[model samples]
Target: MVADAMELATRALLEANLGLAEQVITGDERIDDARSACEEQAYALLALQAPVATDLRTVLAAIHAAESLERMGDLALHVAKAARRRHPAPVLPEPVNRYFAEMGRVAVQLARRAEEVIRSQDVAAARAIEDADDEMDDLHRHLFTLIMNKEWEHGVASAVDVTLLGRFYERYADHAVSVAKRVVFVVTGRMPGTVSDDDL
Candidate 1:
Protein backbone atom coordinates (compact mmCIF):
# COMPACT_ATOMS: atom_id res chain seq x y z
CA MET A 1 0.00 0.00 0.00
CA VAL A 2 2.80 2.40 0.88
CA ALA A 3 4.63 1.38 -2.29
CA ASP A 4 1.61 2.06 -4.49
CA ALA A 5 0.96 5.39 -2.80
CA MET A 6 4.61 6.40 -3.21
CA GLU A 7 4.57 5.56 -6.88
CA LEU A 8 1.37 7.46 -7.54
CA ALA A 9 2.50 10.47 -5.53
CA THR A 10 5.85 10.56 -7.32
CA ARG A 11 4.12 10.30 -10.68
CA ALA A 12 1.77 13.12 -9.76
CA LEU A 13 4.69 15.39 -8.93
CA LEU A 14 6.73 14.46 -11.98
CA GLU A 15 3.83 14.58 -14.43
CA ALA A 16 1.91 17.37 -12.72
CA ASN A 17 -1.15 15.17 -12.92
CA LEU A 18 -4.03 16.29 -10.75
CA GLY A 19 -5.82 13.04 -11.46
CA LEU A 20 -2.98 10.98 -10.03
CA ALA A 21 -2.85 13.21 -7.01
CA GLU A 22 -6.53 12.72 -6.39
CA GLN A 23 -6.11 9.01 -6.91
CA VAL A 24 -3.43 8.93 -4.22
CA ILE A 25 -5.64 10.83 -1.79
CA THR A 26 -8.59 8.52 -2.37
CA GLY A 27 -6.44 5.39 -2.33
CA ASP A 28 -5.35 6.22 1.23
CA GLU A 29 -8.80 5.31 2.51
CA ARG A 30 -8.25 1.68 1.64
CA ILE A 31 -4.88 1.72 3.34
CA ASP A 32 -6.54 3.09 6.43
CA ASP A 33 -9.13 0.39 6.32
CA ALA A 34 -6.49 -2.29 6.04
CA ARG A 35 -4.60 -0.86 8.99
CA SER A 36 -7.70 -0.68 11.12
CA ALA A 37 -8.51 -4.28 10.36
CA CYS A 38 -5.04 -5.41 11.33
CA GLU A 39 -5.21 -3.52 14.59
CA GLU A 40 -8.66 -4.87 15.35
CA GLN A 41 -7.51 -8.43 14.87
CA ALA A 42 -4.47 -7.90 17.03
CA TYR A 43 -6.60 -6.52 19.82
CA ALA A 44 -9.04 -9.37 19.46
CA LEU A 45 -6.21 -11.85 19.92
CA LEU A 46 -5.01 -10.03 22.99
CA ALA A 47 -8.48 -10.11 24.50
CA LEU A 48 -9.35 -13.71 23.75
CA GLN A 49 -6.07 -15.62 23.61
CA ALA A 50 -4.48 -14.37 26.83
CA PRO A 51 -1.12 -14.59 25.11
CA VAL A 52 2.02 -14.11 27.16
CA ALA A 53 5.71 -13.38 26.65
CA THR A 54 6.67 -14.02 23.02
CA ASP A 55 3.08 -14.13 21.86
CA LEU A 56 2.33 -10.91 23.67
CA ARG A 57 5.34 -9.23 22.13
CA THR A 58 4.37 -10.45 18.70
CA VAL A 59 0.90 -8.94 18.96
CA LEU A 60 2.21 -5.67 20.35
CA ALA A 61 4.83 -5.44 17.64
CA ALA A 62 2.24 -6.16 14.98
CA ILE A 63 0.06 -3.35 16.24
CA HIS A 64 3.02 -0.98 16.33
CA ALA A 65 4.16 -1.92 12.84
CA ALA A 66 0.69 -1.53 11.38
CA GLU A 67 0.35 1.91 12.94
CA SER A 68 3.73 2.94 11.53
CA LEU A 69 2.82 1.69 8.08
CA GLU A 70 -0.45 3.62 8.17
CA ARG A 71 1.40 6.81 9.09
CA MET A 72 3.74 6.21 6.18
CA GLY A 73 0.70 5.99 3.91
CA ASP A 74 -0.54 9.31 5.29
CA LEU A 75 2.81 10.92 4.46
CA ALA A 76 2.51 9.68 0.89
CA LEU A 77 -0.97 11.13 0.69
CA HIS A 78 0.43 14.46 1.86
CA VAL A 79 2.94 14.36 -1.00
CA ALA A 80 0.11 13.78 -3.46
CA LYS A 81 -1.87 16.67 -2.00
CA ALA A 82 1.12 18.97 -2.35
CA ALA A 83 1.30 18.07 -6.02
CA ARG A 84 -2.40 18.73 -6.40
CA ARG A 85 -2.17 22.05 -4.58
CA ARG A 86 0.54 23.24 -6.94
CA HIS A 87 -1.19 21.93 -10.03
CA PRO A 88 0.02 23.27 -13.40
CA ALA A 89 2.98 24.68 -11.44
CA PRO A 90 5.61 22.05 -10.99
CA VAL A 91 5.95 21.06 -7.36
CA LEU A 92 9.45 19.88 -8.04
CA PRO A 93 11.62 21.89 -10.38
CA GLU A 94 13.71 19.96 -12.94
CA PRO A 95 17.05 20.26 -11.18
CA VAL A 96 15.76 18.87 -7.87
CA ASN A 97 13.29 16.36 -9.33
CA ARG A 98 15.92 13.66 -9.53
CA TYR A 99 16.51 13.83 -5.78
CA PHE A 100 12.83 13.43 -4.98
CA ALA A 101 12.55 10.64 -7.53
CA GLU A 102 15.44 8.87 -5.88
CA MET A 103 13.80 9.37 -2.49
CA GLY A 104 10.61 7.76 -3.77
CA ARG A 105 12.56 4.75 -5.04
CA VAL A 106 14.37 4.39 -1.73
CA ALA A 107 11.11 4.70 0.18
CA VAL A 108 9.69 1.84 -1.82
CA GLN A 109 12.81 -0.16 -1.13
CA LEU A 110 12.61 0.45 2.62
CA ALA A 111 8.90 -0.29 2.73
CA ARG A 112 9.55 -3.62 1.01
CA ARG A 113 12.33 -4.42 3.43
CA ALA A 114 10.04 -3.54 6.32
CA GLU A 115 7.50 -6.08 5.13
CA GLU A 116 10.22 -8.70 4.74
CA VAL A 117 11.51 -8.11 8.27
CA ILE A 118 7.99 -8.30 9.64
CA ARG A 119 7.33 -11.66 8.00
CA SER A 120 10.72 -13.26 8.59
CA GLN A 121 11.90 -11.42 11.73
CA ASP A 122 15.36 -11.23 10.21
CA VAL A 123 17.60 -8.95 12.31
CA ALA A 124 20.10 -8.49 9.49
CA ALA A 125 17.37 -7.26 7.11
CA ALA A 126 16.00 -4.95 9.82
CA ARG A 127 19.46 -3.40 10.16
CA ALA A 128 19.61 -3.00 6.41
CA ILE A 129 16.34 -1.11 6.50
CA GLU A 130 17.86 1.27 9.06
CA ASP A 131 20.80 1.78 6.71
CA ALA A 132 18.43 2.53 3.85
CA ASP A 133 16.68 5.07 6.07
CA ASP A 134 20.04 6.80 6.55
CA GLU A 135 20.20 7.21 2.79
CA MET A 136 16.75 8.77 2.85
CA ASP A 137 17.86 11.15 5.61
CA ASP A 138 20.93 12.15 3.60
CA LEU A 139 18.74 12.83 0.57
CA HIS A 140 16.44 14.93 2.72
CA ARG A 141 19.37 16.99 4.00
CA HIS A 142 20.64 17.50 0.48
CA LEU A 143 17.19 18.79 -0.54
CA PHE A 144 17.29 21.34 2.29
CA THR A 145 20.71 22.52 1.15
CA LEU A 146 19.43 23.03 -2.39
CA ILE A 147 16.41 25.05 -1.33
CA MET A 148 18.19 27.01 1.36
CA ASN A 149 21.02 28.07 -0.91
CA LYS A 150 20.82 31.64 -2.30
CA GLU A 151 21.05 30.37 -5.88
CA TRP A 152 17.58 28.78 -5.60
CA GLU A 153 15.45 30.22 -8.40
CA HIS A 154 12.06 28.69 -7.67
CA GLY A 155 11.14 31.21 -4.98
CA VAL A 156 8.99 30.82 -1.84
CA ALA A 157 6.06 28.79 -3.17
CA SER A 158 8.35 26.24 -4.75
CA ALA A 159 10.50 26.25 -1.66
CA VAL A 160 7.50 25.44 0.52
CA ASP A 161 6.46 22.62 -1.78
CA VAL A 162 9.95 21.18 -1.84
CA THR A 163 10.24 21.42 1.92
CA LEU A 164 7.00 19.56 2.46
CA LEU A 165 7.92 16.96 -0.15
CA GLY A 166 11.25 16.27 1.53
CA ARG A 167 9.59 15.98 4.93
CA PHE A 168 6.96 13.55 3.66
CA TYR A 169 9.64 11.25 2.26
CA GLU A 170 11.75 11.61 5.39
CA ARG A 171 8.87 10.77 7.71
CA TYR A 172 7.82 7.85 5.55
CA ALA A 173 11.33 6.46 5.87
CA ASP A 174 11.16 7.04 9.63
CA HIS A 175 8.07 4.87 9.96
CA ALA A 176 9.66 2.16 7.85
CA VAL A 177 12.63 2.15 10.18
CA SER A 178 10.32 2.01 13.17
CA VAL A 179 8.57 -1.02 11.75
CA ALA A 180 11.93 -2.68 11.22
CA LYS A 181 12.92 -1.98 14.82
CA ARG A 182 9.65 -3.40 16.08
CA VAL A 183 10.39 -6.56 14.16
CA VAL A 184 13.75 -6.80 15.89
CA PHE A 185 12.17 -6.28 19.27
CA VAL A 186 9.56 -8.95 18.63
CA VAL A 187 12.22 -11.46 17.64
CA THR A 188 14.83 -10.73 20.29
CA GLY A 189 12.76 -9.69 23.31
CA ARG A 190 14.64 -6.40 23.30
CA MET A 191 14.92 -3.14 21.44
CA PRO A 192 18.14 -2.40 19.57
CA GLY A 193 19.82 0.00 21.98
CA THR A 194 17.98 -0.18 25.26
CA VAL A 195 18.86 -2.28 28.29
CA SER A 196 17.24 -3.22 31.58
CA ASP A 197 19.17 -2.96 34.89
CA ASP A 198 19.73 -6.71 34.85
CA ASP A 199 21.51 -6.48 31.50
CA LEU A 200 23.46 -3.46 32.70
Candidate 2:
Protein backbone atom coordinates (compact mmCIF):
# COMPACT_ATOMS: atom_id res chain seq x y z
CA MET A 1 0.00 0.00 0.00
CA VAL A 2 2.77 2.44 0.91
CA ALA A 3 4.68 1.38 -2.18
CA ASP A 4 1.69 2.25 -4.38
CA ALA A 5 1.36 5.58 -2.63
CA MET A 6 5.05 6.38 -3.24
CA GLU A 7 4.76 5.55 -6.92
CA LEU A 8 1.60 7.61 -7.33
CA ALA A 9 2.98 10.51 -5.36
CA THR A 10 6.13 10.51 -7.47
CA ARG A 11 4.06 10.58 -10.66
CA ALA A 12 1.90 13.35 -9.29
CA LEU A 13 4.98 15.38 -8.37
CA LEU A 14 6.72 14.86 -11.67
CA GLU A 15 3.68 15.72 -13.78
CA ALA A 16 2.27 18.37 -11.49
CA ASN A 17 -1.02 16.49 -11.58
CA LEU A 18 -3.35 17.88 -8.92
CA GLY A 19 -5.77 14.99 -9.19
CA LEU A 20 -3.07 12.42 -8.52
CA ALA A 21 -1.60 14.57 -5.78
CA GLU A 22 -4.96 14.80 -4.10
CA GLN A 23 -5.40 11.08 -4.42
CA VAL A 24 -2.11 10.42 -2.67
CA ILE A 25 -2.86 12.97 0.05
CA THR A 26 -6.28 11.57 0.83
CA GLY A 27 -5.19 7.96 0.56
CA ASP A 28 -2.71 8.47 3.41
CA GLU A 29 -5.45 7.51 5.86
CA ARG A 30 -5.54 4.01 4.45
CA ILE A 31 -1.81 3.58 5.13
CA ASP A 32 -2.33 4.77 8.69
CA ASP A 33 -5.19 2.34 9.09
CA ALA A 34 -3.04 -0.51 7.83
CA ARG A 35 -0.33 0.37 10.33
CA SER A 36 -2.85 0.33 13.13
CA ALA A 37 -4.34 -2.96 12.02
CA CYS A 38 -0.88 -4.50 11.73
CA GLU A 39 0.08 -3.48 15.25
CA GLU A 40 -3.17 -4.86 16.59
CA GLN A 41 -2.58 -8.19 14.91
CA ALA A 42 1.01 -8.35 16.14
CA TYR A 43 -0.08 -7.59 19.69
CA ALA A 44 -2.81 -10.19 19.58
CA LEU A 45 -0.30 -12.80 18.47
CA LEU A 46 2.11 -11.79 21.20
CA ALA A 47 -0.56 -12.10 23.89
CA LEU A 48 -2.09 -15.32 22.65
CA GLN A 49 0.94 -17.26 21.48
CA ALA A 50 3.59 -16.16 23.98
CA PRO A 51 6.09 -16.13 21.15
CA VAL A 52 9.72 -16.83 22.15
CA ALA A 53 13.20 -16.49 20.64
CA THR A 54 12.96 -16.52 16.87
CA ASP A 55 9.16 -16.41 17.09
CA LEU A 56 9.28 -13.34 19.29
CA ARG A 57 11.82 -11.75 16.94
CA THR A 58 9.47 -12.34 14.01
CA VAL A 59 6.56 -10.68 15.79
CA LEU A 60 8.69 -7.72 16.86
CA ALA A 61 10.10 -7.36 13.36
CA ALA A 62 6.58 -7.17 11.94
CA ILE A 63 5.71 -4.34 14.30
CA HIS A 64 8.86 -2.42 13.35
CA ALA A 65 8.34 -2.95 9.65
CA ALA A 66 4.75 -1.75 9.86
CA GLU A 67 5.86 1.45 11.59
CA SER A 68 8.56 2.00 8.99
CA LEU A 69 6.05 1.45 6.20
CA GLU A 70 3.70 3.98 7.79
CA ARG A 71 6.55 6.49 7.95
CA MET A 72 7.33 5.84 4.29
CA GLY A 73 3.66 6.62 3.57
CA ASP A 74 3.97 9.92 5.42
CA LEU A 75 7.04 10.81 3.37
CA ALA A 76 5.08 10.12 0.21
CA LEU A 77 2.33 12.34 1.60
CA HIS A 78 4.87 15.13 2.01
CA VAL A 79 5.89 14.78 -1.63
CA ALA A 80 2.26 14.92 -2.81
CA LYS A 81 1.65 18.05 -0.77
CA ALA A 82 4.74 19.65 -2.25
CA ALA A 83 3.43 18.85 -5.71
CA ARG A 84 0.02 20.29 -4.88
CA ARG A 85 1.53 23.45 -3.47
CA ARG A 86 3.34 24.00 -6.76
CA HIS A 87 0.51 22.86 -9.00
CA PRO A 88 0.21 24.72 -12.32
CA ALA A 89 3.93 25.20 -11.57
CA PRO A 90 6.33 22.31 -11.19
CA VAL A 91 7.97 21.65 -7.86
CA LEU A 92 11.23 20.68 -9.56
CA PRO A 93 13.20 22.44 -12.25
CA GLU A 94 13.90 20.64 -15.53
CA PRO A 95 17.55 19.86 -14.79
CA VAL A 96 16.78 18.15 -11.47
CA ASN A 97 13.51 16.52 -12.53
CA ARG A 98 15.26 13.50 -13.99
CA TYR A 99 17.18 13.04 -10.74
CA PHE A 100 13.93 13.05 -8.74
CA ALA A 101 12.39 10.65 -11.20
CA GLU A 102 15.31 8.29 -10.65
CA MET A 103 15.06 8.72 -6.90
CA GLY A 104 11.38 7.83 -7.09
CA ARG A 105 12.18 4.70 -9.04
CA VAL A 106 14.78 3.60 -6.48
CA ALA A 107 12.41 4.44 -3.62
CA VAL A 108 9.77 2.18 -5.12
CA GLN A 109 12.31 -0.58 -5.68
CA LEU A 110 13.51 -0.48 -2.08
CA ALA A 111 9.94 -0.56 -0.78
CA ARG A 112 9.17 -3.59 -2.92
CA ARG A 113 12.36 -5.32 -1.75
CA ALA A 114 11.45 -4.59 1.87
CA GLU A 115 8.04 -6.16 1.31
CA GLU A 116 9.64 -9.24 -0.19
CA VAL A 117 12.15 -9.45 2.67
CA ILE A 118 9.32 -9.55 5.20
CA ARG A 119 7.52 -12.28 3.30
CA SER A 120 10.53 -14.40 2.37
CA GLN A 121 12.90 -13.52 5.20
CA ASP A 122 15.82 -14.02 2.83
CA VAL A 123 18.76 -12.65 4.77
CA ALA A 124 20.94 -12.15 1.70
CA ALA A 125 18.24 -10.22 -0.15
CA ALA A 126 17.50 -8.17 2.93
CA ARG A 127 21.14 -7.05 3.10
CA ALA A 128 20.94 -5.88 -0.50
CA ILE A 129 18.29 -3.33 0.41
CA GLU A 130 21.03 -1.26 2.05
CA ASP A 131 23.00 -1.22 -1.19
CA ALA A 132 19.91 0.03 -3.02
CA ASP A 133 19.49 2.68 -0.33
CA ASP A 134 23.07 3.76 -1.00
CA GLU A 135 22.00 4.41 -4.58
CA MET A 136 19.13 6.57 -3.33
CA ASP A 137 21.55 8.43 -1.11
CA ASP A 138 23.81 9.08 -4.08
CA LEU A 139 20.87 10.45 -6.06
CA HIS A 140 19.95 12.67 -3.14
CA ARG A 141 23.49 14.03 -3.09
CA HIS A 142 23.43 14.74 -6.84
CA LEU A 143 20.18 16.68 -6.49
CA PHE A 144 21.56 18.59 -3.53
CA THR A 145 24.63 19.53 -5.58
CA LEU A 146 22.43 20.77 -8.39
CA ILE A 147 20.48 22.88 -5.97
CA MET A 148 23.53 24.34 -4.25
CA ASN A 149 25.51 25.07 -7.37
CA LYS A 150 26.37 28.77 -7.85
CA GLU A 151 25.01 28.63 -11.41
CA TRP A 152 21.61 27.49 -10.18
CA GLU A 153 19.10 29.89 -11.76
CA HIS A 154 16.19 28.91 -9.58
CA GLY A 155 15.41 31.15 -6.63
CA VAL A 156 15.89 30.21 -2.95
CA ALA A 157 12.26 29.04 -2.71
CA SER A 158 12.69 26.58 -5.55
CA ALA A 159 15.99 25.35 -4.15
CA VAL A 160 14.34 24.75 -0.77
CA ASP A 161 11.50 22.84 -2.41
CA VAL A 162 13.90 20.60 -4.29
CA THR A 163 16.01 19.97 -1.20
CA LEU A 164 13.05 18.97 0.95
CA LEU A 165 11.60 16.83 -1.81
CA GLY A 166 14.93 15.09 -2.24
CA ARG A 167 15.15 14.60 1.48
CA PHE A 168 11.66 13.09 1.50
CA TYR A 169 12.67 10.51 -1.09
CA GLU A 170 15.91 9.75 0.76
CA ARG A 171 14.08 9.28 4.06
CA TYR A 172 11.54 6.99 2.45
CA ALA A 173 14.35 4.77 1.23
CA ASP A 174 15.90 4.84 4.69
CA HIS A 175 12.71 3.48 6.24
CA ALA A 176 12.63 0.72 3.67
CA VAL A 177 16.21 -0.15 4.59
CA SER A 178 15.22 -0.09 8.25
CA VAL A 179 12.46 -2.60 7.58
CA ALA A 180 14.83 -4.85 5.72
CA LYS A 181 17.47 -4.57 8.44
CA ARG A 182 14.98 -5.62 11.07
CA VAL A 183 14.13 -8.66 9.01
CA VAL A 184 17.84 -9.47 8.66
CA PHE A 185 18.30 -9.15 12.42
CA VAL A 186 15.37 -11.45 12.97
CA VAL A 187 16.97 -14.05 10.75
CA THR A 188 20.66 -13.65 11.61
CA GLY A 189 20.50 -12.22 15.11
CA ARG A 190 22.55 -9.19 14.01
CA MET A 191 21.19 -5.67 13.84
CA PRO A 192 22.48 -2.99 11.49
CA GLY A 193 22.53 0.73 12.10
CA THR A 194 19.47 2.52 10.80
CA VAL A 195 19.13 6.16 9.87
CA SER A 196 16.82 8.08 12.17
CA ASP A 197 14.46 10.88 11.13
CA ASP A 198 16.78 13.33 12.88
CA ASP A 199 19.81 12.17 10.91
CA LEU A 200 19.32 14.69 8.13
Candidate 3:
Protein backbone atom coordinates (compact mmCIF):
# COMPACT_ATOMS: atom_id res chain seq x y z
CA MET A 1 0.00 0.00 0.00
CA VAL A 2 2.79 2.41 0.86
CA ALA A 3 4.48 1.53 -2.40
CA ASP A 4 1.37 2.26 -4.42
CA ALA A 5 0.86 5.60 -2.69
CA MET A 6 4.45 6.56 -3.27
CA GLU A 7 4.20 5.73 -6.96
CA LEU A 8 1.13 7.91 -7.33
CA ALA A 9 2.85 10.77 -5.57
CA THR A 10 5.84 10.47 -7.86
CA ARG A 11 3.64 10.51 -10.92
CA ALA A 12 1.66 13.48 -9.65
CA LEU A 13 4.79 15.49 -9.04
CA LEU A 14 6.19 14.68 -12.42
CA GLU A 15 2.95 15.58 -14.15
CA ALA A 16 2.73 18.91 -12.38
CA ASN A 17 6.31 19.75 -13.19
CA LEU A 18 5.56 19.11 -16.85
CA GLY A 19 2.42 21.31 -16.74
CA LEU A 20 0.03 18.42 -17.29
CA ALA A 21 -2.90 19.74 -15.27
CA GLU A 22 -5.57 17.47 -16.70
CA GLN A 23 -3.46 14.38 -16.24
CA VAL A 24 -2.62 15.34 -12.66
CA ILE A 25 -6.31 15.79 -11.83
CA THR A 26 -7.11 12.44 -13.37
CA GLY A 27 -4.29 10.79 -11.49
CA ASP A 28 -5.48 12.28 -8.22
CA GLU A 29 -8.77 10.41 -8.50
CA ARG A 30 -6.88 7.13 -8.66
CA ILE A 31 -4.73 8.14 -5.71
CA ASP A 32 -7.85 8.94 -3.70
CA ASP A 33 -9.24 5.52 -4.51
CA ALA A 34 -6.01 3.86 -3.44
CA ARG A 35 -5.99 5.82 -0.18
CA SER A 36 -9.50 4.63 0.66
CA ALA A 37 -8.57 1.02 -0.08
CA CYS A 38 -5.46 1.25 2.09
CA GLU A 39 -7.47 2.70 4.96
CA GLU A 40 -9.96 -0.16 4.80
CA GLN A 41 -7.23 -2.76 4.56
CA ALA A 42 -5.40 -1.31 7.56
CA TYR A 43 -8.57 -1.44 9.63
CA ALA A 44 -9.20 -4.97 8.49
CA LEU A 45 -5.73 -5.96 9.61
CA LEU A 46 -6.40 -4.47 13.03
CA ALA A 47 -9.66 -6.41 13.42
CA LEU A 48 -8.38 -9.71 12.06
CA GLN A 49 -4.81 -9.73 13.30
CA ALA A 50 -5.67 -8.27 16.69
CA PRO A 51 -2.48 -6.27 16.55
CA VAL A 52 -1.25 -4.68 19.77
CA ALA A 53 1.43 -2.23 20.89
CA THR A 54 4.02 -1.69 18.18
CA ASP A 55 2.04 -3.72 15.70
CA LEU A 56 -0.92 -1.44 16.18
CA ARG A 57 1.34 1.54 15.65
CA THR A 58 2.52 0.16 12.33
CA VAL A 59 -1.00 -0.26 11.02
CA LEU A 60 -2.07 3.17 12.15
CA ALA A 61 1.03 4.72 10.66
CA ALA A 62 0.36 3.08 7.31
CA ILE A 63 -3.08 4.66 7.19
CA HIS A 64 -1.74 8.09 8.12
CA ALA A 65 1.06 7.80 5.61
CA ALA A 66 -1.34 6.95 2.83
CA GLU A 67 -3.47 9.98 3.65
CA SER A 68 -0.41 12.20 3.65
CA LEU A 69 0.61 10.94 0.23
CA GLU A 70 -2.88 11.59 -1.06
CA ARG A 71 -2.63 15.16 0.19
CA MET A 72 0.68 15.52 -1.63
CA GLY A 73 -0.99 14.37 -4.82
CA ASP A 74 -3.74 16.92 -4.30
CA LEU A 75 -1.20 19.70 -3.88
CA ALA A 76 0.60 18.66 -7.02
CA LEU A 77 -2.66 18.79 -8.92
CA HIS A 78 -3.24 22.25 -7.49
CA VAL A 79 0.07 23.39 -8.90
CA ALA A 80 -0.78 21.90 -12.27
CA LYS A 81 -4.06 23.79 -12.27
CA ALA A 82 -2.26 26.99 -11.42
CA ALA A 83 0.12 26.36 -14.26
CA ARG A 84 -2.75 25.82 -16.68
CA ARG A 85 -4.39 29.05 -15.60
CA ARG A 86 -1.22 30.97 -16.19
CA HIS A 87 -0.81 29.73 -19.74
CA PRO A 88 0.56 32.00 -22.48
CA ALA A 89 2.66 33.89 -19.97
CA PRO A 90 6.35 33.70 -20.55
CA VAL A 91 8.01 30.67 -19.01
CA LEU A 92 9.08 31.09 -15.42
CA PRO A 93 12.52 32.52 -14.86
CA GLU A 94 15.27 29.95 -15.22
CA PRO A 95 16.33 30.22 -11.60
CA VAL A 96 12.78 29.88 -10.29
CA ASN A 97 12.12 26.91 -12.54
CA ARG A 98 15.37 25.34 -11.40
CA TYR A 99 14.41 25.79 -7.76
CA PHE A 100 10.97 24.33 -8.37
CA ALA A 101 12.42 21.32 -10.15
CA GLU A 102 14.91 20.74 -7.35
CA MET A 103 12.13 20.93 -4.79
CA GLY A 104 10.12 18.32 -6.66
CA ARG A 105 13.16 16.09 -6.92
CA VAL A 106 13.71 16.26 -3.17
CA ALA A 107 10.05 15.47 -2.54
CA VAL A 108 10.17 12.35 -4.70
CA GLN A 109 13.39 11.24 -3.07
CA LEU A 110 11.93 11.62 0.42
CA ALA A 111 8.78 9.76 -0.54
CA ARG A 112 10.87 6.86 -1.80
CA ARG A 113 13.00 6.89 1.36
CA ALA A 114 9.91 6.81 3.54
CA GLU A 115 8.62 3.78 1.66
CA GLU A 116 11.94 2.01 2.07
CA VAL A 117 11.99 2.69 5.78
CA ILE A 118 8.49 1.34 6.18
CA ARG A 119 9.17 -1.78 4.13
CA SER A 120 12.42 -2.64 5.87
CA GLN A 121 11.47 -1.34 9.34
CA ASP A 122 14.80 0.41 9.29
CA VAL A 123 14.83 3.05 12.01
CA ALA A 124 18.16 4.39 10.88
CA ALA A 125 16.85 4.95 7.36
CA ALA A 126 13.89 6.75 8.91
CA ARG A 127 16.28 9.20 10.51
CA ALA A 128 17.75 9.90 7.09
CA ILE A 129 14.24 10.65 5.83
CA GLU A 130 13.82 13.22 8.57
CA ASP A 131 17.11 14.86 7.63
CA ALA A 132 16.11 14.96 3.95
CA ASP A 133 12.87 16.67 4.97
CA ASP A 134 14.87 19.41 6.68
CA GLU A 135 16.63 20.10 3.40
CA MET A 136 13.26 20.37 1.66
CA ASP A 137 12.07 22.89 4.24
CA ASP A 138 15.11 25.03 3.60
CA LEU A 139 14.57 24.88 -0.15
CA HIS A 140 10.96 25.91 0.30
CA ARG A 141 11.94 28.95 2.32
CA HIS A 142 14.40 30.04 -0.33
CA LEU A 143 11.81 29.65 -3.11
CA PHE A 144 9.28 31.64 -1.07
CA THR A 145 11.74 34.48 -0.78
CA LEU A 146 12.32 34.50 -4.52
CA ILE A 147 8.61 34.51 -5.34
CA MET A 148 7.77 37.29 -2.90
CA ASN A 149 10.50 39.53 -4.26
CA LYS A 150 9.01 39.38 -7.78
CA GLU A 151 12.39 38.39 -9.11
CA TRP A 152 10.93 37.36 -12.45
CA GLU A 153 7.90 39.68 -12.69
CA HIS A 154 6.19 38.24 -15.77
CA GLY A 155 3.20 40.44 -14.86
CA VAL A 156 0.57 40.69 -12.11
CA ALA A 157 -1.31 37.55 -13.12
CA SER A 158 1.86 35.61 -13.81
CA ALA A 159 3.35 36.75 -10.52
CA VAL A 160 0.28 35.56 -8.62
CA ASP A 161 0.38 32.27 -10.45
CA VAL A 162 4.05 31.74 -9.69
CA THR A 163 3.51 32.64 -6.04
CA LEU A 164 0.73 30.08 -5.75
CA LEU A 165 2.89 27.52 -7.53
CA GLY A 166 5.63 28.01 -4.97
CA ARG A 167 3.09 27.65 -2.17
CA PHE A 168 1.68 24.45 -3.61
CA TYR A 169 5.15 22.98 -3.98
CA GLU A 170 6.02 23.97 -0.43
CA ARG A 171 2.85 22.43 0.90
CA TYR A 172 3.62 19.27 -1.01
CA ALA A 173 7.05 19.08 0.66
CA ASP A 174 5.47 19.69 4.05
CA HIS A 175 3.08 16.77 3.64
CA ALA A 176 5.96 14.49 2.66
CA VAL A 177 7.78 15.56 5.82
CA SER A 178 4.64 14.88 7.81
CA VAL A 179 4.57 11.32 6.44
CA ALA A 180 8.22 10.81 7.35
CA LYS A 181 7.51 12.01 10.88
CA ARG A 182 4.71 9.50 11.16
CA VAL A 183 7.12 6.77 10.11
CA VAL A 184 9.43 7.92 12.90
CA PHE A 185 6.63 7.63 15.45
CA VAL A 186 5.64 4.20 14.20
CA VAL A 187 9.18 2.92 14.42
CA THR A 188 10.36 4.70 17.59
CA GLY A 189 7.12 4.96 19.57
CA ARG A 190 7.43 8.75 19.76
CA MET A 191 7.22 11.82 17.52
CA PRO A 192 10.73 13.01 16.66
CA GLY A 193 10.59 16.74 15.88
CA THR A 194 8.97 20.10 16.61
CA VAL A 195 6.11 21.19 14.36
CA SER A 196 4.76 24.72 14.06
CA ASP A 197 1.24 25.36 15.29
CA ASP A 198 0.59 28.12 12.80
CA ASP A 199 -1.33 27.37 9.63
CA LEU A 200 0.53 27.62 6.35
The parts of candidate 1 lying over 4 Å away from their true place are 192-200
Query: Each candidate's TM vs. the true structure?
Result: 0.93, 0.96, 0.79
lDDT of 1: 0.86
Task: Assess each prediction's global lDDT (C-alpha) against the native.
Answer: 0.86, 0.90, 0.66
**How displaced is residue 9 in candidate 3, in Å?**
9.8
TM-score of 3: 0.79
Colliding pairs, model 3: none
Model 2, 1-78: lDDT tens digits are: 888999999999999999999999999999999999999999999999999989999889889988999999999999
lDDT of 1 by residue, 71-114 (tens): 88999899999889889888888999999989999998899888
Off by over 4 Å in 2: 194-200
lDDT of 3 by residue, 5-111 (tens): 33343343334334345566566788789899999999999989999878998899889888887877777667655545544433355466666667767766776
Candidate 3 — which residues are off by over 4 angstroms?
Answer: 1-19, 88-91, 150-152, 191-200
State the local distance difference test value for candidate 3.
0.66
